[model samples]
Target chain A: MMTDLPLDQVRTLLAVVDEGTFDAAAAALHVTPSAISQRVKALEQRTGRVLLLRTKPVRPTESGEVLVRLARQVARLEHDAQAELGLSGEGEPTRVSVAVNADSLATWFLQVLTRVPEEFRLCFELRREDEDHTAALLREGTVMAAVTSSPDPVPGCSVRSLGRMRYLAVAAPKFAARHLGGPVARTLTEVPVVVFDRRDDFQDGFVRGLTRGRAGASALRHYVPTSEGFVEAVAAGLGWGLVPEPQADPLLGDGRLVGIAPGRRVDVPLYWQQWKLDSPALVQVAETVTATAAEALRP
Target chain B: MMTDLPLDQVRTLLAVVDEGTFDAAAAALHVTPSAISQRVKALEQRTGRVLLLRTKPVRPTESGEVLVRLARQVARLEHDAQAELGLSGEGEPTRVSVAVNADSLATWFLQVLTRVPEEFRLCFELRREDEDHTAALLREGTVMAAVTSSPDPVPGCSVRSLGRMRYLAVAAPKFAARHLGGPVARTLTEVPVVVFDRRDDFQDGFVRGLTRGRAGASALRHYVPTSEGFVEAVAAGLGWGLVPEPQADPLLGDGRLVGIAPGRRVDVPLYWQQWKLDSPALVQVAETVTATAAEALRP
Candidate 1:
C-alpha cells in the first residue's frame, strides 16, 4: 500500500496534466522537458501504476486522478497555511473553487457571493455544471465544493442539504392555447418541448410522472442549454419546459408565461458537499451559502 | 492506402466511446462483450492504429477522434437523407447541432430560433461553449455549425462573419465610487474585477490595452462564468467587468450601473461556421442565424 507520495513528483504530474504535454509543463515550471519526463516516470514507478497517457495533451489515468486530487488538496492547504503565517504577500486573495448548477448560479448562488464579507478577500473560481454532475467535479477534486442533487457525501467530504429547488411546468400563453388543447399527459407527449441539454431528463421525468411512465416529452425538443435561455425559449413559444419557480414567477406574473400543470411541481433537493478541510475561507463560504439557501430554497 | 472504413465498425467505436466501456457498449448495442471486442480489434487491425486507451471509462486516442468525427458526420448525413426521402417517421424533427457562445445565447441567438418556421419541424441541439472554442466542436463533428470568434474555417467547414459584439467596461455606481477614485488604468489594476471564467482574459486584455501592456486586471477577480451572472455580479458591487452591450444597456439606463471607462469599448468580431453540407435543416438554420446576426450584431 502507498503511504506517501513525493511532493515534487506529484506536482510534476499535475503540471503535465494542466499544461497538456511534457514540453509545455517543462516551460511552465521552468524545467527541462527531460526533467518533467523523469519526475513522471519516477512517480509511476513509485506508485506502480501508469499515471498519464502520452496523448497530445496528456490525460490522467484513473490512478492519476487520485494523486492529482491529493496534489490539489495539498496545494490548497499550503496556501491556507501561508496565509495564516503571513508568508503569503499582503492582498493576495484566496481562491475558493466551487462547482454550482447553472440555475442556482443565475439565481440565489450569486446572492451568497454578495453576502460574503469583503474582509474575507476570497476570489471565487466558479465552475458551472449540471446539478447531477457537479458532484463528479467535487469527487475528482476539480473543485473543493459543489452544489449537487445528491445528498450522499463523497469519501473524505461532508454533505448538507441546502433545500429543494422547485420547478413548475410552464409555457407561453399562446403556446398553451395552440398545442396543449387536450389532456396534458397526451398533449405534452406530442407538442414541442424545451430541454436544457441532451443529458437533461428533468422534463421527460416530469412527463413520465404525469403519464404513469407511459410516455415522455416530445421528440420535437428545443435544446436551450443555459438556464436563462431555457426560460426565455419557453416564453417565446418555442416549447414548454419545467422552469425554476424563481425564474417562472416573474414571467408568469407578467402574463408572458402560464403554469401548464397547476398544483404539480418537481422539487429537486440540493445539497452542499465539500472536503472536510478546516480552511477559513471555505468555512466562511459554507456558512454564507447555507444561510442564503435557507432563505432562498424550500426547506 | 486507406480507402474506406466499415460503417458497422465505425458505429461500434462511437458506441464504446459514448458508453465509456466495452461492457456498457455491448449492453447499449445489444451485442455480447466478445462481439464488441472483436469489432474493435478488427477496426484497429484494419486501420493499423490503436484507437482506444482501454481505461475503466474508455477514452479515444488522437486517431480515434478522427474516426469519431467521421462517424458523427455520417450519422448526420444519413438522418438528412432519411428526412429528404420521407422515410423518417411522421412528425420526426430533423436535429441540427450547433455551438454558440453563452453571451450570444443569452442575448440574440434565441431570436434566431423563434424565427424558424414551425413547418420545418426542426429539433435544435444547442451546445453552449466559449466563442474561442466552438470551432473545435465543429471540427470534431460534435456540432454541425458554430458561432465562433475565428475567421478561419475548420477543415470541411465554411465560415462567415457574424459582426462584432461590443463590450463596455462598467460597474455599479457605488463600486466605482469606492474603487475608481484614481486614474482609470491605475485603479483598475488594483481593484476587484469580475470575469467569466479562468480562461477569460477579455478583461485582462482590455486592461492591457488601456495600460499600454503595463498590466492586466487585478488578481482580486471573481469568476461568475455565465454572461448574465457576470453582469449581475458587477451590478451587485461584487466586481466591475466588461458587460456585453445588450445586457449592459438596461442597467446603464437605470442608475444601477455606470460606465467606468467612457468612450472605450472592446468589440469581439463573431463568425458563423458550418459543415459544408447540403442538408435542408442545416441550410435553413445557417440562413436564419446569419440574417439575425446581421441585424443584432455591429456591422
Candidate 2:
C-alpha cells in the first residue's frame, strides 16, 4: 500500500550502487556504516521489493536499479535547476551525463556535443552503449538521453523520430564472386559472415529475412567491438556483413566491396528518446541531433 | 569548468518552475524574492545559458528543460535510496516515475506491472508520450526508464532488443470497398486514411513504400488519437488505417473489417531501453517486458 517513496532513500540506493557498499556510502555521507545498512534495510521493507543484493560491493536488485537510476536523474535535474535560478556557486561546472550507442557515436551522435553553447559551462560524461540498450541507462539514471530503435517512448518521457538509417549488405568484389553464387536470398545462408559480437544479430537477422528462417551465414565469427574495426573486418574479407550504406558506399564504388545482392537494403529507423525535461542543454542537444539526423539519414 | 553542479541550485529551479514565479520560489524556499532572482541570475552567469523565460507561469528554455528533468530524476533516485537505506518514515512507499507511449500501454506494457512484487509497495506515475520521444524523458531525468523506438540507449541507460511490432493496413470491409479499389498498392494513395495526430506518418510511410515515392495516402485524413479509438475509427468505416495485427485480427475474423491487401505487413523492430542500473524493480520490469514482447510481437 506504499504509494510514495522519499527521495532521500532513493538517492542512498544510487550511492550504494555507485560506491558499491554500505561502508562506502557511510564514508561518502560521513555517517556510520550501520546507519547506511539500516536505511537500505528500511527501504527494502517499505517497497516490499529487495532493492539491492548485498554482495561484497553491493548491487541494486532489478528493482533497486530502477530506483538508483531515478535517483541519478533527479540529482542531475536539481543541479540544472539551481544554476538556472542563478544560485550557483563560485566554482564548479555541472556535468551533463548521457548514454548513446556505438553506431550513432561514429556517425552523428558526437556532433551533438559540438553544438552545446559555450555558456552552459557544461561537463560531459559520455557513456558508450549499443543503441538497442541505451534506454537502460536512462532508466538507471546513468544518462539523460539515448539513441534507440524503439518507437515507443520510455515511461515518463517524450519521443520524436529522427529518421531511418540505411544499411547495405556488401562484400569484397572478389569475395562475393568466390562465395555467393546465385540469388542473394538463396546463397546468403551458406556464405561465411563476420559477426561483430555474440549478441550481434545483424548478420543473422539479414539472413533470416532472405531465407525466412532456412539457415544463417557461416559461423566463422570476428568479434570486433568497435564500429570502425567491425567495418574494417568486413572490408578485409573476413566475411560479408550488413554494413551501414554510408560506410559501405565508397568501398563498394572503389571495387573494394561489391553488392552480393544489390537493390535490397535494410532501413533501420532511428529515433532520439530522452527525458521530457525543460533543460536548455538537453534541448540544444536534441535540436542539433535531429537536424543532423535529417541530413545524414533518410527522411 | 563546472564539472558538477551543486544540488541546491537545481532544487531552486524546480521550486521556481513548480511555483511559477520568483516570488513563489522564494516562498517555497523560505527566502526573499530578491534572493530568488539573485540565485537564478547567478546560475545563468555560471552556466552562460538562459535557463528560463520570464513569464507569469515561467517556461524553461531548452537548456532549462534539461535541468527540470534532471532535478526530477535525481529526486526520485534520492528517495528510493533513502528508503533502501532505512531512512524513510515507517510507512512511506517509493514512487517510480516512468515515461511510456500510449500504444504499448494499450497493448502489453501493463504486464510489466503485474510482475512486480506487491511488497515493493511502489506507485507508478506513467507519462504518456510518443515512443519516438520517450528517451527525452530519460534525458531530462523525468523518468527512470522508458519503452522507446530508439535503440541507442539513453546516456546512462542500458538497452535490449525487445522484438518487433507488426502492423497491417485494414478497414471496415465497407470502407475498403468504397474508397480503395483493386490492388491496394495502387489504390491506397487515393483512399481516405486515419492518422493519430499532426505527426502521424505510419500510413504515409506505408504508402511511400508501396508507390516508390510516387504517391502518398490521401490528404483526406481522419485524426483519431487513441490506439483503440483509432482502430475503431477505421473499423467504423471512417477510413483505412494501419493497425497492429493483434488488434485487427478479431475484427477481420468477425467480418467487421478486411485487409486492403493481404500478406503485406510492416514489422517495426522494437527494443527495450532502460538505465543500466541494477535496481530490482527495473530488472523485473525488463524481464517481464522482454518476455511479454517475445510472446506478443514478431521476431
Candidate 3:
C-alpha cells in the first residue's frame, strides 16, 4: 500500500488543498491546471476514495484529510533530510511549528525556546490554542508538535509527561469579602466569575469539585483570553477565577489577589507530544521543553 | 413578521446551534426533546425555510445563522434594558464582550478597559483574534464590539476611526549588517523575516511596497503568534519584520534593534466598531477606546 502511493500525486493533492483550487495550485506549483487535476484524480483512483469536496475553494473530505496529514508528514521528513544533507539554501533556517496553550506561551514556553542551541539556526512558528485543543492541531498536521492536555498521542506522534500546571482559585480581597465570604461552593455558583474563554471549564470544574457536582461557576462571567490579562482581571476584582500558579503567585504575595478557596487548587496535567521522527532539531526542542516543564510545572 | 418570530423560538435556535444537538439543547433549555422538535418546526414554518441541518450534532443553515444572530442581539438588548431598569440581580455587573486583535490587546487596548468608570461596574469579556477577523465575531454576535482593520461596519454596528497603527521594518543591528547590507528591497526577499502568523501580510506588503510589487518577504520566516513575543523574536535577531511602532521604538532606542529601512513604514488604519445600542456601558467603552487610540496611534 505504501508503494502504491506516489509522492508527486500526494504532493499535488496537498497543493490543491492549500491553494484552494486547481488553478491556484497549478500557479503555486508552476504546473498546468489540467496537470494538477490529473494528479489529484490519479491519487483518488489509487486510493479508491473520493478525496475532495469540489466547493468554492475546495474542502478535503474525511479521506482527503487523512492523505493531507500523510503529505505533511512526508514534507516534514523531506525538509529535515534536505537540512541534514546540506542541500538546503544557504542561511535557510529549519522551521518547527508547535501549538501551545496561552498560559504555557506566557509563562515557561519562551524559556524552552531559549534553551535550544542557537547553532541549529531554528525558526519557530508558534500557534496559541487551549491545551485541550492543541492536540487537534497536531492531528490535523497543522503543527509538528504540541503542548496538550491529552495523554493520548496523535497518530504518528509520541507523548511524554510534562508535569501538571496548578491553578489556584483566587479573587481580590474586596471581592472575596463581598461575594465569596458566604458558603464557598454555593456563593461561587451565584456570584460573577472570570473564565479564560468560552471553552474554559477550569472555574466550573473547580466549583463542581468543591460542591460535589452540585454547582458550577456563575454565568455572569468575564472571558479574558490572555493568561496574563486573565490574572489581572481577577486581581482587579472583576471576578474570581482559577489562575495558573506562575501567574497568581506575585499578585497573591502583593495582596492584589487573595485565595478564595485556600488549600484547594486545580492541577491540569500537561503532556509534550511531537512527531515520532529522528530529526535532531525536533529532539532538541522536545528535550529542552521537557526539562523546562519539569522545573516550572508541579510534579 | 418580527412579532411572529417569538423570542423563545429564536433563543431555542441559538441553543440548538450552541449545544450542537437537539437533546443537548433540550437539556440546556430545560425542555423535553418533543418540545424542542416542535419549536424548531414552528420556526421553520414561520421562516418558510429549514433553519437547521439536523445532523448528529445540529448545524445552523444560512437562514439559521441569521436568526441566531438576531437572538443574540435581542439578548443583548434585553440585558441592557434590565440593567437600565435596575431589574438585574443585585451586584450584577454590566457585561460587554469585545473581540480585539492581539497587538491592540498587548499595546493600548487594555488601557481602554481601565478607563471605564467604576460606577458602571462593567464586566469585560475580551476575545483576542486578528484585527482582520475581529469583525466576524461581531457579525456572528459572539462579541458586542470589536477593534477591526476594516472601516466598513458589521451590519447593525456603528464604526469610529481609531487611527493608523504604524509598522516599521526593523532588525537587530548585527542581523542588518550581515543579511541586509545589499539593496534593501532585493535583500529583504532573500533574508529571513519574522511574521506574526500565517495570516499576517504586513511584512509581505512592506516588501511589495519597497520593490513596487516586484518582490515579497522571504519564505524563510519565523512565525511568532504573539505581538510582544514577535517583537522580542526580532530583537533577539531571529529575523527582521514590520514591528508595530509603539513596540519597536523602545527596542530601537535601546540599541537592541535598528531600522532596516529608515523611513519605510506601513500604517494600518484601525476602527472601533460596536452594536448600535443605547447601552451606556458600551458607549463609555467606545468613547474611552477611541480617545486612547487617538493618543496612542498615528492619525
Best by lDDT: 1
For every candidate, the chain B TM-score is 0.93, 0.88, 0.94
Q: Write the per-residue lDDT of candidate 2 for residues B1-299, one digit (tens) a residue.
A: 43477668877887898788998899889999998888777777778899898977997777887777667766767777887887977445555555656566556665554456657655444555676568666765666777766788777677888777788889888787676777787778766677766577889999998989988886656555556656766776767888987888889899998988777889887777676665666666667778888888788
Q: Tens digits of per-residue lDDT for model 3 on A166-223?
A: 9899999999998876778889998878888888888998899999998788877878
Clashes (backbone N, CA, C under 3 Å), per candidate, total 0, 182, 0
Per-residue error at B277 for model 2, in Å? 39
- Pairs with backbone N, CA or C atoms under 3 Å apart (clashes), candidate 1: none
* Model 1 CA RMSD to the hidden true structure, in angstroms: 2.9
Q: Which candidate is the best by TM-score?
A: 1
Error of 2 at A59 (Å): 1.9
Give the interface RMSD values of the models in order. Answer: 0.9, 24.2, 2.4
Clashing pairs in 3: none
After aligning candidate 2 to the native by TM-score, how far in Å is the CA of B75 from where it should be?
A: 52
**What is candidate 2's CA lDDT for residue A156?**
49
Output the TM-score of candidate 2.
Answer: 0.49
Q: What are the root-mean-square deviations of the candidates from the true structure over C-alphas? A: 2.9, 27.6, 3.1
In CAPRI terms, model 3 is classed as medium
What digit string (tens of lDDT, one per residue) describes model 3 on residues B1-299? 77778889999999988899989999999999889999999999988999998876887776787788789888877887897788988657777889988888878887776678878878788989876567667776778899888888888789999999998889999889899878999999988888988888889988998899998898778888887778877887778988888999998899999999977788889888888887778888998898999999998
Which 10-residue window in model 2 chain B sums to the lowest lDDT? B90-99
